[model samples]
Target: MISRFSNVNRAYVNTVGISSVFNIGDSMQITPSIKVLAIQREQEIYYDEEGKFSQFPIFEEEIPQPVFYEQLTTNFFNKNPKINVDSISVTSISSSAILQIGSTKDIVCESRTKHIRQSKN
Candidate 1:
């Protein structure tokens, strides 16, 4: 049963030199899901009259870089010699299904919408 939808919340810049945040936990699935809750732009933050700001949609600017799950594994391992990641899952950007991430794979998503509304660069 899906509860809430939340996009992968982006955090600070990592060693790979990209901005990132923790994606919705693999185990969590809420129907009315909140895939991501990103902050709007600088000027819009001050003048958006629609109260859309209340929603606080995720902003592309806030997310400068998005390193894939595989990348994370390599980067994480390199930084902490003591830590060892084994498995990882990759998400399909075009899918609606929530992403499943492991220690050494990529995150994957089973998309709901057929036409990927998200802007792909």
Candidate 2:
């Protein structure tokens, strides 16, 4: 699981990379169900009292990201009738640092109204 922070110091989940599956002891194999979250930032366009259009930072609520699950192998389950399911091992890999977005232009605002409506609910 990798975490990223916005300019306002909001910590959000950026990515989840599963390199391998969890092994139930050295006998049985299992599947993985991963959940991820991400945030999309944008600018809100509105007219001021003076009738001049302006933009302001508006960040949408965190939403679920994509997760890829690998299929479990049936060979291991078939071989081991009495599976040793007491212990489990998780594989870990070196993760790279989080990259930050540069400026307000990077944030999209085309769907600002739609996001705002959703957030209220």
Candidate 3:
């Protein structure tokens, strides 16, 4: 139950609090159910003088839309059949921005998928 919502540099979280470690280009599940969002992706194709295309694959990687609470609720429901995150939002808290691990924060293990939860309200 730490307040995830703040005016500056603080994020609003729904079920879970700020991730112990956040990073750019990292996929974080702010809640138990939210999944990755697919947004408009762009790529530049190389061309020859005669408009011939190159054989190399296009490079595309964008920082996804700043995670949203509504999207998180929807994903949470789809992932969990028993508990709905929507109900939790109605009662508990909703976050605005996700806490991303920056260069200033301490970095833990790189390749670990850890899930930490709060036991009390």
Best by lDDT: 1
TM-score attained by model 2: 0.17
lDDT of candidate 2 over 15-34, digit per residue (tens): 43442222112222223322
Segments in model 2 whose C-alpha atoms lie over 4 Å from true places:
1-16, 22-27, 43-121
Report residue 62 deviation for candidate 1 (angstroms). Answer: 29
TM-score of each: 0.18, 0.17, 0.16
Global CA lDDT computed for model 2: 0.29
Distance from true location, Cα of 79 in model 3, Å? 44
Model 2: how far residue 19 lies from native, Å: 6.8
TM-score, predicted candidate 3 vs. hidden true structure: 0.16
Cα displacement (Å) at residue 107, model 3? 1.2
What C-alpha RMSD separates each model from the true structure? Answer: 16.1, 18.4, 20.4
Flag the better candidate by TM-score, 2 or 3: 2
Q: Once superposed on the true structure, which residue ranges of model 1 sit more than 4 Å away at CA?
A: 1-29, 35-45, 53-85, 89-97, 101-121
What lDDT tens digits, residue by residue, belong to model 3 across residues 1-121?
1112212233333453322232233242433222222222244433344222232122122324545667333222233222112211112222222334322222222111223232333
Candidate 1 local lDDT, 22-56, one digit each (tens):
34333433222223333354343443554342344
